[model samples]
Target chain A: MSGGAERRLPGHYLKSKEMYSLPGLVEYRPVARYLFSAGQAQSRFLDGLKEGKILGKRCPRCGRVYVPPRSYCEYCMAPTSEWVELPGTGEVHTAVVSYISTFRERMEKPEIVAVIKLDAPGYTKGGYEFAGLFHKLCNVEPEDVISGRAIGMRVKPRWRPPEERKGDVNDIECFEPVES
Target chain B: MRPNIHVKNKVAVVGAGLTLFRRRMLETPRELAWEAASMALESAGLTLKDIDCIVIGTAPDAFDGVHLNGEYLADGAGGVNKPTVRVYVGGGTGVFVPIAAWWHVASGLCRTVLAVAEEKMSPAHPHPQGVFAYIWDPVLERPLGPNLIWIFALEMRRYMHKCGAKKEDIALVSVKNKANALDHPAAQAAAKITVEDVLNSEVLVWPVNRLDISPVSDGAAALVLASENEARRITDSPVWVEGVGFTLDNTHWYNRELGYPRYVQYAARMAYKMAGIERPWREIDVAEPYDPFDYKELHHIEGLMLARPCEAPKLLKEGHFNRDGDLPTSPSGGLLGVGNPIAAAGVMKVAELFWQLRYEAGARQVKKPVHRGVAQAWGDLMQAGTVIVLGN
Candidate 1:
C-alpha cells in the first residue's frame, strides 16, 4: 500500500526450475557425516538399553532424574551422583500420528509417536519436571489419539529380542499399552 | 534476576532497511546484507564510512552451507577494518543484533553501529527443516526420527489442551497475519487467506497445516544505531532504544510445561523493568511478538505479559490484536505474514516497529496513536527470548 515501493524490495525470487537450470549458479550438497560421543552417563544408559533396561541419573543436589542421562544436572549445576534402573514403563503424555519421515517422505503406514512420562517416585504427577523419553507407540489406532483416549494410559516398552539388541533406543521396538 | 542499570550513554535507532523476503533468491548472502546495509546508510544520510562499528547476526551456518558465515558477511555488513562481532540465538538472532549494537553505544565504545541480520535458507537441499537432523541430539532424540513439524504440532496440541484453544482459534492468527502482509512491499507470503483455507491446507503434521507456518525465506534486514547525541544530529524524530532484554532457559525443553514460555516472560520482565513500564498489557502501545507459528504469536503475547495466560485466544477472537485494535500486534504482518528467513525475520519485525514509531509506515501503520512499541523473537530450541522496547 505504500506508494512507489509497491512490489519493490531488494533480492530476486528464483523460480523452481531456474534454481536447477540457471547457469553460473553454484550447486552443492551436504556430505552428511557425524561421529557423536556418548559421554560417561549416556554410555552407561546405552549399556542398560543393551540389557533391556531403562536407566536414569539422579541429581543429588536437586533429586531430579534425567532419562537419556546427562552427566550434569542442568538445574543444580552439579554432577549427577546416582544411577537408578527404571521399570521401563510409563503413561503416554502426548502422542501424534506422523505421516512423514525426517526428509518429509510419506510413509505407507502412519507412525504414532508419543512422549512417555517414565515411572518415577520423586516427580509429581502432571508436574512441569519429569524424566521422559520420546518414542514410538503401538497397539493403538490413530482414532485413540484423535479421540483423546490414548493419553494418560499406562504403557510399557516392546523390546526387541536379546540377540537383536544393539545398545540403542531402537532396542525397544515401541511402547504399547500395558492393558489389553 | 535484574540486569545492571547504570550505563554511560543513551542509544537510539536512526534508520532501518529490509530486502524482499522470498523462498529462493538470486543474490548471495553477502549481497543481501550489502543491499540492506546500503539502504539503511542511505536512509540515515550516512555512508559506510560513518559507521563506527558493526554487529552482525545470522542463523546457524548449516542453512547457508557455508562455514564461518559471519566473517563471510563482514565486508558486506560494513565491517571491513572496524571491529565486527556476530551474535546468534537461532531465530532470535535478528532482535539480538540491535541488542548487541545497543551495548556498543551504551558502553560508550562505539558512537555509531550498523546492526545487520541475514539468512539464506534456500541453499540447503531437500528442505531447510532438514537442518534439524543435525540439531537433534544424536543419542537420545534422533533415534526417534522426528520431523521438525512434529515439535510445533506437539506444542500446538499442548497449547490447545492447556488453554482450551481449538485449531479454529489458532487458525485465526495465520489468517490475520497473512492478510496484513498483503500491504507489505517486502512481503513474500502475504495473502488474503481465510481460516478455512488454513484448515484445508496440506497438514504437514497434525494441527500444523502448511499455511499455519511462515514460509522458508531468503532475506536480510539492517538498522542504524547511534548514541543520543549522534541520533539527534541524524534525525529529529529518533526512536530511542528504551530497553533490551534476552534470556536462555534450560535445554531440557521437554521437561518443562509446553503450554507457556517462561523464558520469554523472564526476558520481557527484564525489558519492561528497564523501560519503567510496569503494566506491559496497558503501557505497550503496539507490539510485534514472534509468530513463526500461528500459536506461537499467542504464546509469546502471554509470555510478554500483553495478555494473561490462555487469554490470547479470547482476545484474538475479539479482534483485539487487529491492526486497528486497542493493542495491535504484528502490524508488520510478523513472521507469519512477512516471511521467516530465520534471523532476518526478527529484524524485519524491529524494522516495522521503527517505521511505526516514526509514523513512516504508510498503510501498514496501526490506527492508534502509538508512542511505544516492542518487538521480540524466540529461537534456540524454544529457549532464547530477545526483546527490544522502542519509544519516540
Candidate 2:
C-alpha cells in the first residue's frame, strides 16, 4: 500500500493444452542414467544383505554404528574401522501407509512403509542418531498404523529366498513384525 | 557458539521483491528472476549499475530441467560483468542467498549485492515429484520406490506420536496460513479452509492429505543488500541483517530421530547468539518459519525456539500464531498458503520479514510493534536448516 501501488495482480494462468500449443515451446526428454558405486562401506553392507545378514560400520573414535554404512563417521569425522554384524531386529521407529507408488500411481492394496531402527550397541536408548533402514513392512495391519500400534513395535527383516537373493537393499523382502 | 571473527562492515536489506507464485507461468526462469530483481532494485532506489556483486540461489537443476542454472540466470539477476556466485543447500538456498550476500557486504568486499532466488517446478515431466526422486540415494532409498511425501509422512507421524497431537491439531496451521494468504498478492493456494476440509481432502499418505501440503510453484524473489553506509544513503528504513546462520546435518536421515529437528535448532541457536538474543520466545516479535507442510511449521517453531518443545500445538490453539496475535507467525502467509518454489519460498519468507520490519507489508503487517523478526528454511532430506534474524 506504500507509494500508492497495489500489489495484488493475478498471474496468468495456463491450461495444459494452452501450454503445449504455445509458440517456441521446446520439449526434450532427458535420458540421464547412472551407475552408482555403492562405495567401500555400503558395498560390504549390501554384500552382507545378500548373505542374509545385516551389516553396520562402527566409528572407532565415537563408537557410533551406521547402517547403510559410510566409511567415514559423520559425527567424529574419523575413519570407520570396524564392521559390525547387526541382529536385524529392532523396534519400528516410524511407520506410514502409502496408498500411492513413487510415480503417484494409486495401488489396489495400500503398502506399509517404515523406518526400522536395527539393534546396534553403539548408541544409547532415546539417542538422536541410530542405525536404521527404510523399507517396506509386512504382517502388520494398516489399522495397526492408524491405531498407533505400529510405531515402537518390535520388527525383523524377512529375507528373500537364498537363491533369489541379490546384493541390494531389496535382498530383504521387507521388515515384518516379530511375533512375541 | 560465538563466531570467531568480527566483520568490518554491517549489512542491511534495503529492498525486497517477489513475483507471483503459480503452478505454471508464461515467463521462463530467467524472465521471472529479472522481473523480481528489477522490482527489488526499484524499491531500493538503486539500479544494476550500483550493484557490485550478485548472489543467486536455486534448488536442483532437475526441477527447472536446466543445467548450470546459476550461469543461465546470471544476466537476469544483474550479474553481467559483475562478481556473481550461486549457492545451493537444497531448500535452504532461499535464506542462504541473503546470508551469502551478507558476507559480501560485511567483509567490505562489495558495497551492494543483488540476491535472487528462483525455482520453476513445472518443466519436469510426469510431475515434479518424479524429479524429487533424484534427491534420494539412488542405490538405497530409490530402490524402495519411495515418493517424496513418504519422508514427510513418516516425520509427521513421528511428530504426532511423540507429541500426542492428533491430526486436527496439526491441521490448524494450514487453516490459519491459508486464511492469512488471502491478503498475499503472490499466493498460489490461498483459501479460507477449515480443519474439516483438510481432514476430508485427498489422502496422499496416511497422515498427509492434499490440503496439508503446499502447492508446487514456479516463482522468483529478490533482495537488495548493502553495507551500513550504503544502506543509510539508499533508504530511510533499511532492515539490518542482525545475524545469519546455516547448518547441514548428516544425510543418513533415516538413522536419526525424526520427531525433532536438531539441525534447525542448531542453526537457530547460531543466529540467535549472533543477534545477541538470549530468549527468542520473548525477544523476537514475529517469525516466518518455513511451512512447506503444516506440521513442519510447528516442527520449525519449536526448532527455532519460538516455543518450548511440544508447546507449539497448544499455543497455536490459543491463536498465538495468528496475524493479530502477540507473536504473529507467517503474517504474509507462509509457503503453505503462499506458494513454495523451493529456494524462492525461503527468499519469500525473508522478504516478508523485510517488508514487515519496514511497515510496508500493507495488509499482512502484524498488529504488534515489531522490532525483531526471524525467518528460517529447512531443506535437503531433512538435513539443512538456514536461519536469518532481522531488525528495523
Candidate 3:
C-alpha cells in the first residue's frame, strides 16, 4: 500500500488507461426468445398513446381505475374488470435533469425527465399511486427541475403526429405543464 | 407442513463451487454458470441426472444484455426440462438461490436441487454503467444525471455522519477485505492494501473512493442442496441451512431515514428467530454482509446485528472485523475485494461460509473455529434484504 496524496490509487491509474476491461468468463445464450405476457399490457398502453388518449383499467371490486392499466389490482389481489378512457393529463410528481446519457456518458445537452401522477378515482394521499407514468419533460427549463418547482405541477401529454404514430412508448413526444 | 411458514423436510447444502473472479472474462454468462455448476456437482459426487430441480439467481438482465435472463441462462444452469425457478433481490439473489432450493427440497417436492448464480457485467456495450441507468427512477431520480456512485456516496456520508466514522475508519474495511481477498481464488480485486492507500485512492464521490468499492466482474457460483436424508447420503460433511429470511420495503427510499437498514434488521431478526438464536451479535461466528461498497459492509454489519449500528466502524478500526479478529467477517474477502458479480457475489459468500463451517476453506479459513455463520445480501432500490443462517 502506497502513501501520500500525490500518488494515485491503482484504480485511478486503471481509469486513466481509457479502457476499463471486464472479464466474461461465463458463456450464456438463450435458445428461444421469451414472449412475456407483459408485452400485451405494454401494447395496450401504447395503443392509447397513439390515439392521443390515455387509458386505464378499472377494478369493479375496488372501483379504482389505474392510469397505466393493470390486469389485476396489486392491493386487493384481484383482476381488473373494466377499461376506462381518459384525457392525457396529469401532474408532475417529480422531475430531474440528466446531464448524462443512458450509458452514463456525459452529454452535450441535458434531458429532462418527470413522473406524472394522472387524475384517478381513488381517495386519500397515496391513492394517486395508480395514476403515474414516467416520461420526458418538455417546455420546461432545467432550472425548473432543480428548484423543486417541477413537482406537483400540472402537465399534459404531447403526442406525435398521427401519421408518425406507432404502437410503442415513444408515440408521445413528451409531457409538459398545463398553463393553469 | 404449512404452505407458507415451514417446509415438511429439512434441507442441507451438500456442496458448493465457484470459478475464479476476474475483471473481465471471455465466457458468456451461461458458460460461467455451467463451469460452477459442473464443479459443484462433481464435488458432491453427483451428476445433472441426479438433480430434480434448478434455481437460478442473477442481478439484472441488463448487465448480460439479455432480457428475461432467467430463461436465457436456463440451459447452462441445468434448468432444461426441469422445474426451474429464478429468484432475485439484487445482490441478495445468490444466497437466496440456495434458500429457494431449500424450499424445493424441504417441501418434499424435490430431493435434489441445483442452484446457480451468475453475472456477466462485461457483456454490456458501453460499460456496465449504461445498465445502471435503469435502476434510477425514470422521472425523478434519473433526471438528476446522477452516477451510480451518488447513492453509495450519500449512504456513506449518512453513515459517517450518524456513526461519527471518519473516512479513515471506514477505509479499514477496504484494506482488510482486499487483504483477505488476496487468498481468494476467484477474487478479481484482491490486494494487500492499507488504510493510507484507501485514503489516497481517487474519490468517486466524497466519502467513497475507487478503493472503497468493489470491482465489476463476471463470475458464477453454484451449490447443490438436498433434503437432510439425501444430504447425508451424498456427503459426510453437509452444511445445514438452519434458517432463511427475506423482506422487501417500499420503494419510497427517500421517505425513510438511512442511518440503519431496518429492512435488513427485520430480515435478520426473522431468520434468527427461525434459527432459534436469541442474540445474533453473540451467536454469529462469522459473517458476510453485502459490500458492493466498503461502507456498505459496515452498514450491513450493523443491519445483520453483528455489531451495534454505530459500533461497527469503531470495531472495524480496531481490527475486530478481520479474519483473525474475535469475530471474523468476510473471511472469504467479500465483494469489495473478491468481485461483485452481484448475484453471484452473494452466493459466493454463502459458499465460503459452507466451506468454513466444514473446515474446507483450506488456506482461506478463519483463525478461529467456526460453527455458525450468516450471509446477507441487500439489493433493489435499497429496499430488499435477504439473509441466511447456516451451521454444520
Candidate 4:
C-alpha cells in the first residue's frame, strides 16, 4: 500500500526534431474559415459605431446597460428592451503593454491595451461589474502602464475618419486620454 | 446557493493514475487515455468489465486535432457499450471530469465510473498559441490579434495593482511549485529554479515571463469513482468525495473586476457549504488551486478562501504554503512545475489530493497530518471555476 516505492511518473518526452523526423508522423494545417454573424444587438451597435456613435443595450427590468450590447441581460435574464447612446468616454478599468504580437513574435512597437469602463449610468460606481470595451490605448506611453498611471485614467474613443469608418469594432481606431 | 437535496448515495475515490506529462509523446491522445485508464483499473483491482459508466474530460478539440474527442476516446476510456459523457469548461475540464463522475455514482445511477482527462497540445502546428486564437470572440476581441497570454497578463497586472503585490512576491509560487515537481514522475517542467531565474526568464508579456507560465504539455490522468458499498469492497482506504461545485461567469470578462475570481468564490462557497465546512482557512489541510500562471495560484487561493483576500502572497513569503508549511498548496508542483495538458492537469490535482489523503503521495506528500483537502481549477474566458473537496 506504500506509494513511496513507486517509480517515477509520466510518459517519454520527444524532441521536436525527433518527432518530425520519425516515419509515419502526420502533420496537418486546419483551414477553419467562418463568417460569424454579429447578432442583432451587436450588429446595431456596430452600425452605430460606423456613424461615430457608441450604442449600448439597456435591460428594462434591471436598467443595466451593456456596452458591446447583448440582446439580453446576463444578471436579470431579461431581454434588453432599450437602446442607449453613450458619449464613448470612460476611465481605464485595467491596462497592459504588450511586447509580443498575437503569434508570439516580437513587435517593433509595443501596443497598450486597456479595458475601458464606458460612461454608462445603470450600474453602481466602482461596482464588481460594469459596461466596458476592450481596445488599444493611444497617446499613452508604455511607461504610463508600467508606472500604473494608465489604469483609472479618463479616456475617450479616437474614431476613424467618417469616410473611412467601417461597421466593426475597429471603427474606433483607439482610445486616448481625454484632455482636461 | 442551497445544497442539492436529491443525492441518494455517497461517492468515494478508490484509485488514481497518470501518464507522464511531456512536451510530445509517441502515443496518440486515445492511447494516452488508455494507458492511464488501464493503470487506474489495475490500481483499483478492476477492469473495463467492472466499470458501469465512463466520464471523459479534454480541454479543446483543437489541441487534439480531432473533433468529437469524447467519442474518439471512448474505447480507450473503457466506454464501448456503456453510457459515456464528456464535460468541458476550458482548462477547468480536468476537475470537472471527476465532478461529473461524482454525480453518476452519487445519484445511484451507476455503481462504478472511470473518470479520465487528457490533453495533447503538441498536435497543433507552428505552435499551440495559434490554436488558442479561436477562444477569442471573432467580432470584437479577435480583431485586436491577442495572444492567449494577454488575458493572463492583464489579470496578473490587475492582481498586482489591487493587492499591492510585486513581481518578486509572485515569482515565489513558480519557485515553490517547480521545486515540488522535482519528485513527480510525470512532471515535464520540473526544475530547481530561483526567483532571479524566474524574473530573468523571457518576458512574453509585462508582469509575465516564460517561466511564469506552465509549459504546454501532453498527458492523461484517470481516477476510479464508486458508490460507498462498491468503494468499501474495492479498497480499504477510499477517499470520500465530500463535495463538488462548479460555476461559470458571464463571458464579458473585461466588464468585470479582474482583481479577484468571483466565479471561483461562488464555486468554492458551494462546495464548502455542501461539505459542511464554514471555516476553510483552517479546516482544509491541503490544497491545489489552479496555477497555469503563478499569480493565478494566489488569485485562486483567495477565491477558495484558503487565505484572506490579498493575504496569500504575504503568507507564501513566510513559507505558509510550502509542503512543510501549514496548509501546503500544490504539493504536486501544480501546472507550473507539473506541466499543463489543460484538462489533464486539473485531474492531476484531484488525484494528488486523493493520494495525499491516503498517505500515498510518496515523496510528494505534505508534512502535516491531513484530513480534508480541496482541489480547484479555473478556465474558459475567465469564467468557469470547478472545485472538489476530498477527505480520508
User: Over the stretch B319-352, how does candidate 1's per-residue lDDT look in tens digits?
Assistant: 9999999999999888888899899999989988
Candidate 4 lDDT by residue in tens digits, B241-272: 99899999988899898999999999999899
TM per model?
0.96, 0.98, 0.72, 0.98
User: Residue by residue across A1-180, what tens digits does model 3's lDDT show?
Assistant: 000012211111123123334343334443544333434444586687778787777777767666566688766878887777766777765555555555556667766765566766452334324466667789888767544466568898788898898755567778888883
The lDDT, on a scale of 0 to 1, for candidate 4 is 0.91
Q: DockQ, in order, for the candidates?
A: 0.57, 0.62, 0.07, 0.66
For this target, which candidate reaches the highest DockQ against the unseen true structure? Answer: 4
Q: Over the stretch A131-179, how does candidate 4's per-residue lDDT look in tens digits?
A: 8998999999978887888878999999999999989989999999999
**What TM-score does structure 1 among the candidates reach?**
0.96
- Segments of candidate 1 deviating more than 4 angstroms: A1-7, A124-126, B1-4
RMSD for each model, in Å, please?
Answer: 2.1, 1.7, 8.5, 1.6
lDDT (Cα atoms) of all candidates against the true structure: 0.88, 0.90, 0.77, 0.91
Q: Output the chain A TM-score of model 3.
A: 0.76
Q: What is the alpha-carbon RMSD of candidate 2 to the true structure?
A: 1.7
Q: List model 2 lDDT by residue over A55-148, tens digit each.
A: 9888888788888789998767899999999899999989999888888888889999998988986555338888899999999888998889
State the lDDT at B184 in candidate 2.
88
lDDT of 3 by residue, B298-323 (tens): 99999998898799988887878888
- CAPRI quality of model 1: medium
lDDT of 2 by residue, B1-392 (tens): 34554989889999888889998888889999998898899889898999999999999998998899999999989999999999999988999999999999999999999999999998885578878778889889988899999999999999999999899999999999999898888988999999999999999989999999999999999999999999999988989998888999977789899999999999998899889888999999999999999999999999999999899999999999999997899988899998999999999999999988888888888899999999999999999999999999
